[model samples]
Target: MADPKGFMTTPRQDWPRRPVGERVRDWDEVYVPGALLPIISAQADRCMDCGVPFCHEACPLGNLIPEWNDLVSRDDWRAAAERLHATNNFPEFTGRLCPAPCEAGCVLAINQPAVTIKNVEVAIADRAWELGLAPPRPPDRLSGRTVAVVGSGPAGLAAAQQLTRAGHTVAVYEKDDRPGGLMRYGIPEFKMERRHLERRLDQMRAEGTRFRLSTAVGRDVGAAELRSRYDAVVIAAGATAWRELDVPGRELEGIWQAMEYLPLANRVCEGDLEESPLSAEGKHVVIVGGGDTGADCLGTAVRQRAASVTQLDIYGQPGADRDHEVEPWPTYPKIYRLSAAHEEADALGTAPSADADARLFAASTLHFTGDADGRVRELSLVEVDAGRREVPDSTRTLPADLVLLALGFSGPDRGDGLVDQLGLAMEPRGTIARDDGFATNVPGVFAAGDAARGASLIVWAIAEGRSVAAAVDRYLTGSSRLPAPIGPYDRPMVV
Candidate 1:
């Protein structure tokens, strides 16, 4: 209500990204620093503050979008940040990384462009950090009840922070040498800088949440022993078993999984590694699967100065514009997306000529042709039919010195010693099966995030973690006071 006619007066303005040529030289984030603050207030004013905000229902965390929008429009960034952090534990992460389904579900989007909720969120969070509003909230008193949270991703971190504030002693266990799971390792630095992840981790540590890095529960300590040592155990181990393209010549020296390639690039950016083992430098790279992972690889390869890059997808091409008939307003549309990586690649003149980001739809890989030295030289492919069957007459070969299988993950790796030692029951889809309360078949052990749910958004992971913590808190105290952001059966609004 800052301005009743604000929506009509101001049009939605998106946050500006850095110049493609300048940003590609290094691993800094694509967004230009201090670029959004100038226009963010006008963008925030565009919020309608609807009678029944659909954006609330769209967000898993039930973020106070309208309230914060009003606060930001009035130049009250401190209050805006407070309102944002009231529900979401880490707005900085989600604001930068999340696809912003809430904007799709906005009431304004029914007619005009939606409010720039994501940009406003980032502005609020950045302002909070500048003003020192984002301080640690250590609990006033410790409950003396101990909780062991396994995982250092968004879910486990949110759960640990919430439980710690609820007066419980919490310890977060991460198998990796550093914390932040996928955020630290899986995500590229150019997409989201590591400083953002580290700053949030610093706050969490200050809040009395103890972190045990490089210590996996099932490996370092027995799963049963971990359960016995703590009053409650919450498992937030993410889904990491990658889905592979089972075709001929899969064992070639240059053919690698996306996880193998992406993490190495990330580690190199962190200065922890000398060089990536599967670098695309001076090589023609072919990425199979046209998802976010593929786009990430495309950008990384371009940065590494790949000789050429091509991406393939089994599905048909998506419409350039939004499809109103198939994917209507108030829901996330199935349309062509031009991510920051795509923009950078397009500017470099190395992008594919298909009017998109080096993507070839309705294409399936046949096999890879290898050089005499056992390294991949080229990839054999064919046009896919309506049923995704390869057509014989449309066969072709593309030169590729390196091949990355960006074909997404299946679920958590069951072969990991942790799942076997815990004897956790898994559903048919390979996800750990939890009861109504997010408790597994075991009495006191609970599961959450990508481990219980399949591969999902960071917001969903945090919501699941918060909900599972409430369930564990109630189980320990008979009755407890904690916010359950989502239930066990809850799915994302966009998905």
Candidate 2:
């Protein structure tokens, strides 16, 4: 246990963020550099090390939270890193990107603030790398088997790393010019610097995980050829089929899907372009969707010096605290929380919506008005009731030279032809269908992550990756020792 009574004595304090004025000027991560190491140990002490430890149940990766908290509190960073890496393959990625349901389920959060689990996890991961404790662990002997992992996202990377460490010749095929999947192109550099991703890629390469970049599995190489070449295949091509908004004037010159806008901005950061062709500079931007992706667009637009920004959400605004009767403890709650991107938008006075955070809840987009040049000039919206029916006389309009649709993804993109070529079965929700063991209808093939489960958090992706690797190993070598933390159908504790 971290501290028998330290949970009572110490109050939870999270890692501090860089000032908005300074951070908004560049694409660096928002957190203050070199600030976490000092406060992380104290934050780790706040872990009560509960007898039940609901945090474990909340995390999809089944991370050893209490064990590592104790190790961190005792200043055994190396041991803490080992315990953290025991279950989670990419704590750094999750620490930065995940919403941290583990913290919501923390025993301390029953009444008090939860322990700073995310900050502590990131600190341990960063320290592990700095201390040379996270070296590549090449296999002792080759299993004489080969595995092909489609996609370079978290799930595919995790599966490939585990398979490689298990002595299988692992090859990861990616359609993008670089790996890391969305982490490389969809996610902004301000959220998490790509260097963290690059470091992992280097480690994977050192461990003999070969990456086939710009190679679409079903397009460049035939499905039959891949099946005959590799002993096994794992499809982790994440859900990227974006849900479209069927509204009028959606094809205006300045309107773009969140995926399209985010990737182009990311390309600018990647040095592929001197400037984003879809820059939001000097435009009035209205984002239709009040999710993380929408906030990402808001932040990007704010950084691009958008004249004004407004984000609309179909759902009503949630309360500040959890409704105990409804959501209760230990389950992820629907509460109003300010993400870093929203914070930036709020601090910069970019969001001109009803909420202070630049978000207008219970709002539905009706249509867009365009200028004579066929560019979006304004957006029409109306306030809705609980059932999503527009309230009478509540219609309004906002200046919107640029419109971004950040509606969530539906399923894996079918443009690559992998599903059709392999004859993979799909669910009604458009996700690939798999068995309890993560196996697809096609023999010697398995699926995991967003491709099979639809859009979800990064932690779930890593968990699915680990689980599918174990299942694939068992199929390949008959009874393997790889850990499978969660099954393919495992879900998080959310109301």
Candidate 3:
């Protein structure tokens, strides 16, 4: 147990953020640097170390939450780091980005606020890095077998690291100029700095994982040739195909997909360009889709000095607190809570809660209008019911100098010809299909991450990587020692 009476004695506290005025001017992370460290141990003590520990089950990575919490409370950061790394390949990414479903599954949430599990997790990982406890552990002997991993994102990186440490010569192929896939480009730097990703990649290189960037699999190298060269292949290629809105004027000049806009901004941050070609500067922006991607666009646009920003969602706004009647305890709920991006948006004086002005709810785009130059100028919207039928007399239009479709991704990119060349099976949802062991129909070929499970969280992607690595190890040498944390179809029961 963490602390005998800590739950009763202490109340829950949130990670503090920087003053909105100070943070928005710069691209640094929203949190106050080194602020959480002072209060982390007390927060870790709030974990009850329950008999069931539902937090473990809730986490897709199967993280040893209670064990790490105990270690954190005991001031044993080294042991906490080991426990965290035992299941999760990347806590730093998740700690900064994951919604913390573990907290929703915490037993403490039955009566009181859940323990600050996410804060403790980040604290442990950061302390380990500061103390140099995380070192590259290269294998002493090679297995003489070679494996090729496609896509250098979380799943591919996790699988590559595991295989390389197990003494197999593994090579990672990335079509982009650099690795990290969405982590590198899809995500903005204000949420998490690039240095964290760089330091981790450096460790992977030290551990003997080879990377070949700007070299695609099916285009540059034939799929048949790749399969013949390596003993096995792992496809961790994430879902990158952006979904489109089939409304009128969608083909206008100023309309762009969220992926098209977000990455260009990220490149500017990376010093790749002086300014983004699709910069939202001095424009009124309208984003369709009220999920994280939409929130991301809102923050990025505000930073770029946009004249105005509006986010639209078809679904009704959820309550400020969890609706226990509909979504009971121990299950992840869709309640309203402010994310760092949302907080930044709130600071911009957008509608406080979800409404028609800023974070509009129950709104759907009916059509769009454009100018003589074929550039989008305004958007037509209407209020809808649960069945999606329009509410009477609710049609309206908003000035939209630039329109962004943050409407999420469909599946992995199939234009590269890997799917056709390999003859891989796809699920109904457009993701690659795999069996119980994360193996494809073709023997020795496996899939993981968004390529197999469709678009999902980074925690789930890393979990799939660890699980598939174990399956591949077993297939290679008949049996293996690495832990398989999840089955092929295993997933969390949340939205």
Candidate 4:
């Protein structure tokens, strides 16, 4: 346990982010270098020695929150890293990207601010690398079994790493030119640097995990061939079939999906393009979504120097504090919270409203208006009530030279021909159908992550990946020792 009285005496302190003015000018991560290490220990000390740690239950990966918090508070960085890695395959990725539902479940959060779990996790991850605590551990002997992991996202990578460490010859197939999937192309550099991903990839390579990049299964190689070649196949292709806006004039020239826009900006950052042709510079941008993807678009537009930016949320703005009756303790609540991208938009005065953040809640899009050249010019919208029913006399129009639809994804993209070629069963909602053990209808074939679970948080993706790997290992050798955090049907911690 951490300091017994520390929770009562110490207040939570977060790692300071870099200044908005300086951070917006460049594409580096928004964190102040070397700032987290100094403050993380004290923040870790704030973790109570609660008899029941709800934070552990809240995490999809079942991260050892209390154990790591105690280790970190004691300044045992190495042990903290080990305990963190015991459940999570990629602490650094989750530490940075996850919304930290665990914090919401923190025992201290009942009356006080939660311990800085996310910050402590990241500090241990970075310190582990610096202290040589993290090293590639290749298997001592080969199991003579082969596994093919489809996709290079979190789930696929986790599965491949686990199988490789268990002595299986694992090969990861990625259609993209690089590994890391969305982490490489969809996520902006400002959120997380590519170096962290690159180093992890290096470690995987050292551990004998093979990556077959720029290779599309069912296209370059038939799904049948993939199944015939490998003893087992794990499909972690992810849910990338982006939802489309069906409003009128959505086909206008300047309209794009968030995936389309984010990847191009990421390509620019990767030196593949000098500058994005779809740059938001000098344009009035309007994003149509309320999720993290929309905020990502907001940040990217702000960086590109968009004239003005606005994010429309279909639901009404949530209250600043949790509604205890609706969402009690240990349950993740829907409350107003400012994100880094929103902070940047607010600081730069790039949002439509000067006082509030970039988001306009209860706003629903009616249609878009285009110019002479068939380019989007303005957006028509109306305010809505709790049920999304339009309110009377609330129609409005906003100048929108560029419209981005960040409406989230429905399920896995089947355009790659993998699903059709394998005759895989899919749910009505478009996700691949799988059993409790992560097995698809086809024998020796499995599906995990967003491909099977639909779009979800990064932590869930990694958890599913690790779980699928255990099932695959058991199928391959009849017995295995790999850790499986959750089954396919294990739902997230929600009310």
Candidate 5:
């Protein structure tokens, strides 16, 4: 264990992000590169290493947080990476993107700020990579079986890598031009650089996981035909059916889906486009939704030199501090989260609101008003209570040259014909149905990730992928040694 008194000796500290004024001018990540390595050991020492270690139960990947924390605190970067990778396939992505529910489960959080587990995880993984610890360890022999993985997000990639290491042939099919489904396009570069993703892809390729890009499993290649070709199939196609607001003027030219607008900016990062077709340049942008996706749009708009930007949320803002009365210790609380994007948005704000933040909480959109040329010029909104009952005489209008619907996803993309082709059973909650082993209704077919669950974080996606691969391995050989990380219906530390 680390120093028993270390928690009391060291205060919780995090990596310093780049200045808002400087980061908004470029697509680089907000964090300072290699700036946390020296102090990360002190931060890791802050872990209490409790007897229960609720942090493990809180993580979907069931990461050995205490073990790795101890290793990091002792300056054992290679061993820390080993303990982290034992459960998680991609620590780099999760360390940067996940909300860190493990911190909420930390016993130290009961009194003081939680240990910077995410930072320690990233520091270990990145240091191991720098020291050439992440090399391809190809399987000694072949299993003589082939697996087809649909979608190339975190889940599909995790499944593919695990299956390949298990000595089975794996081919990942992606609808988009690139292999990464959402990670390639949905996420903004300001949050995470694309190089991290590219390096991992290269490692997977070195281990013999083939990628079939721009190949839709249901459209370009028939799902039925694919099932016959491969011994087994894992459908990790994420929930992409965007939830929409059907209010009036939704069909205006300036309106777009979050998926639609986010990818355009990503294309610019890919050098495929000099500028996004729907760039918010010189426009007043209004982003609907208060989640991380909405914050991403706000940051992207500010980077695109928008005249002004505002984020609207249907629910009232959460408390600044955790509500222990409603969600007590070890539970992921719904506190007001000011993401890095929100901080950047604050520095870039042009108008001064009453609350001094760009966010408009407890707000509801009524309708949009377009110009004579049928382009959206403004939108109408009103205030509402927690019950969604409208407040009297609260109607207001704001100029909006561009309107982005970041209202989140409803379910899997049904229009792509994957469901119709496979005849997969779907739950009423708009997710693909699967058994305890992650197997679908169809024999020899399985589902995982957001396709089987609702829209969730990347940690859950990678966990589901790793779990489903073990099931497929058992199905193929009638017995296997791979570890199952989660059940089809398992959720961790969800408040």
Candidate 6:
């Protein structure tokens, strides 16, 4: 249980970040390198190791947080890494990207700051890489079974790795030029560098997971042919259909979707493109969403030297601290968060404009005012009621050279024709429907991750992948030894 009184003796300390000004000018991660390792062990020592371990309940992967906290506190890094890998397939990714619901569910958080679980998890993973502890564990023998996995995102990758190790020949198909799906193209470089994604791909390849990039299953290859070629098929195609705002002048030249803008920046980072078509350089950018994607756009535009940046949200601003009455502890809180991008934006004094970084909470876009050249010049907005309905006589206009619709996704891309060709059923929400085993109406064809569960966190996606792999293994072999970390219909306690 770590140190019996460690919680009392050592106060919680988190990873330190570089000065916002310095980090904004570069593409490196926001945190200071090597800054957390020195204090992480002591921070791990502060874990109380509660009897129930609500953190396990909090994590979708059901990670053994207390055990590893004790292992790390004792400086048993190799063992800690092993324990971490026992449940989570990509702690490195989640350690960086996940919102850390486990920390919110920590017993220590009931009174004080939670243990630095996310930082310690990343440290253990990094140490494992340094010590050569992580190695490919390819199957000893092929099972005479082949599985076609569509999508190379975290969920698809996790399922592929698990199925490969379980002695199945798994082929992953992606429409992008490279694997990693949204991880490769949608995510900005400053938040999480590509090296982390590449290393995992290397490990997956060594474990015999074959990848076929730039191949859309339903388009390049017929869905029937895929079903006939493989013993089973797993659909992990993530939600990529960006939601659009249908208003006047929606097709203006300078107006774009967040997905359209973000990937171009990522492509530039990959050296595939010298310049992005949606570059915000010297432009007045206004993002019309308040989620992580919008923050990402804010950061990327700042890096691109946008003359000014503003973000708008339909909902009112959340409180700075947790709202215990509305959202209790051990559940994810709907509090205001200052992400690294927000910090960087604030540091540049490119603060949201008077309408605040020009946010008009409870506001809705009315139309786009454009110049004669067909370029967007300004945005017309109207005050909205709690229901997001436009209120009368509350119109306003704001300068916006470039307007990015940061609205969230609607569902997976249907352009591939797989859903229709395979006769798969979709929920009313546009998400693919799957049973408890993640199996579609078509037999032997399973679904996982965003494809099955809709847009969600990377941790949930990976967990769903692992679970679906177990189900697929069971379907193939009648009985299996693989772990079922989650069910298709199961949602996190918070979600």
lDDT of 4 by residue, 1-495 (tens): 667888888888998999999999999999999999888888888988798999988998889998999999899988988999899878999999999999999999998989999999999999999999889989999999999999999999999999999999999999999999999998899999999999999999999999999999989899999999999999999999999989899889999999999999999999999999999999999999999999999999999999999999998888988899989888989999899999988887787552268988999999999989999999999999998899999999999999999999999888889999999999999999998889999999999999999999999999999999999999999987998988888886666
State the displacement of the C-alpha of residue 108, model 5, in Å, after optimal TM-score superposition: 0.5
lDDT on C-alpha atoms for all candidate structures: 0.87, 0.92, 0.87, 0.92, 0.90, 0.88
TM-score of every model versus the real structure? 0.97, 0.99, 0.97, 0.99, 0.98, 0.97
Q: Return whichever of 1 and 2 wins on TM-score.
A: 2
Residue-level lDDT tens digits of model 5 in 328-404? 98999888877887787777664344143678888999999999999999989999999999999999888999999
Q: Write model 6 residue lDDT over 438-478, tens digit each, in one string.
A: 89999999999987787899999989989999999999999
lDDT per residue for candidate 2 within 1-495, as digits (tens), equals 757888899987888999999988999999999999888888888888789999999998889999998999899988999999999878899999999999989989999999999988999999999999899999999999999999999999999999999999999999999999998988899999999999999999999999999999889998778988999999999999999999898888888999999999999999999989899999999999989899889888888889998999999999999999999999999999998888888888886566668899999999999999998999999999999998999999999988999999999999978999999999999999999999999999999999999999999999999999999999999998999999977888766
Q: What's the residue-level lDDT of 73 in candidate 4?
A: 87
Instruction: Give me candidate 3's TM-score against the actual structure.
Output: 0.97
* Pick by lDDT: 2 or 3, better one: 2
Give the C-alpha miss distance for residue 60 in model 6, angstroms: 0.8
Candidate 1 vs candidate 2: the lDDT winner is: 2
- Candidate 3 lowest-lDDT run of ten: 349-358
lDDT of 6: 0.88
User: Which candidate, 3 or 4, has the higher TM-score?
Assistant: 4
Off by over 4 Å in 6: 352-360, 389-394
RMSD of 1: 1.5
Clashes of each: 0, 0, 0, 0, 0, 4
Error of 2 at 355 (Å): 1.8
Runs of candidate 5 exceeding 4 Å displacement? 354-356
Structure candidate 1, residue pairs in collision: none
